[model samples]
Target: MSPSMPDTPTPPLALSPPDLRPWRDGGSGVDHVHVRDSGRPGPTVMLQALTHGNELCGAIALDWLLRQQVRPLRGRLVLAFANMAAFERFDPNSPYASRCVDEDLNRVWDDAVLHGPRDSVELRRARALRPFIDAADVLLDLHSMQEAGAPPLAICGMTDKSLPLARALGQPATMLVDTGHAAGLRLIDRGGFADSASPRQALLIECGAHWEAISAELAIDVSLRFLRHLGVVDADWAESHLRCPLPERQRLLRVGEGIAARSQAFRFVMPTHHLMVIPRAGTLLAEDDGHRFFTPHDDCVLVMPSRRAGEAGQTMVRLGRYED
Candidate 1:
């Protein structure tokens, strides 16, 4: 197996964070929600960004959409910048510091959590945006990876609802079917979005590592393709801004489970990259204070292995495989 690159003292700041002050007021009743409806009437397509404040690729992509004045010809297009409070704290020197001011916005989508007494910057924003999210016929949440050199992939969740949409997109060769985090519910996992029979579908794409220029470009390319797929934007418009190669074929991986770091001392047997395939069953992968981890099955694949051992209960990496 190839060795992981040495940790950079500071990851290069490849792109500037977009200034989103103009979009804060929003067209919808809520803040950061802009909706444009075509009189012809079609699906209400939503493109969301800034779910995690540290993930700037999404913000840059949304900013481009607003700057280009991209509008729907048939369906309604909703451009939302979620968690502005956290995004306000983004600093190039500490790129990962502002993931969220209080709690992870992506994990607070559960109906109970939205309606409960627990309150924070993320929860409030998610609560205010639930109605808009529920109204979306198709949704795309943009994000970026934590580890450098990881390939971009479309996260289609554990269900088949998003599988067709994943295939329709022109970029990203790998599609991951995830069961989601045990810590909380994600927006993609909420209501009809995850139901196989429901017309409402959503996908989250990790567009390479945060703070990299390539991630922003990947976000824009994928977003354009997604808009084209829903007929929210014309092929001509999409083709004009296309900057990446279309995948010849796509592979599907079904995530089995996430391996949590028991403590800050957790360590992998060797540094692993995202999508690394393990050939044998019971292969040693990692170890914590007194705990050990091994592959549950043969041909096991590692998805998004973290460089940081991380605190207790944080996901170190996820184990997955090709869907047979």
Candidate 2:
């Protein structure tokens, strides 16, 4: 049996989708992608937004930068609005329906999928954006969550290099270390970005709840910090726009497993919050049909518990543990 949809009404939309018509004919051959080059030699830092159309904070951040005329001081600054086809369909009345037009754009980054004959609205755009993504020496993919009021998270892809960069950024307060989903590879884990020996690094920030007013604020702050950290933008300008104070330290959570729902009956014992830590090893977290989920170890962290009803094979939540 299919799961029943949640009875709760969607939250009020607090963010206005920025007007992107001005960026349609960007300098980059690909539509909706803008590139700025500095004559001096430096790394190409790419700031990508709109990976998921429903996530508006990223687009807001990039739009703010463009309006401010922020450009690289030494390197190339690539500001890309990815998955614009999906973004174009964004409707405030049914926001989540437009996360992607077909398959998730973030999951199609693997070469096999990119090279294969399989087609999607998302796949085609990913292909067009691939060359620029490949050229980037540093990348920051802006994203947000479905759960309201959740704290911001830095999804540091599975590499030794990313954790340190997240540590250096120093906000967001929590960082998650995990491999890409079984569904497919994420853009952050694609190519040299995932290779420990490669200098290419990427960080995907889940700024806050999708459609929340604060999410846009956090996105812009993080974008400035990222540019400032890499010396891509002038220090004075970056500092001028940065509104958030740095967190004293950021905590790391290494995800051990992603729990996929096996049946429509899957449900948590109680409400779950993002980054909520279960204190006991055997405490019940959720149930699916007849099976129950328990914390694997003491103080297991629940990462991004699904706000919607779970469908079979959908990842409901990820379980992780804090690193000392």
Q: Once superposed on the true structure, which residue ranges of model 2 sit more than 4 Å away at CA?
A: 1-8
Which tens-of-lDDT digit does each residue in 151-263 have in candidate 1?
89999876977988999895698898988888788888888998887889999999988878889999999999999888889899888998889878889989977898889
Model 1 scores a TM of 0.95
User: What clash count goes with each model?
Assistant: 0, 0
Worst 10 residues of 1 by lDDT: 1-10
Colliding residue pairs in candidate 1: none
How large an RMSD does model 2 have?
Answer: 2.3
Candidate 2 per-residue lDDT over residues 161-257, each given as its tens digit: 7988888788789998886688889999999999988989999999998889889999999999999999898889899889877777788889866
Best by lDDT: 2
- How far does residue 267 in candidate 1 sit from its true spot (Å)? 0.6
Q: List the global CA lDDT of all models.
A: 0.86, 0.87
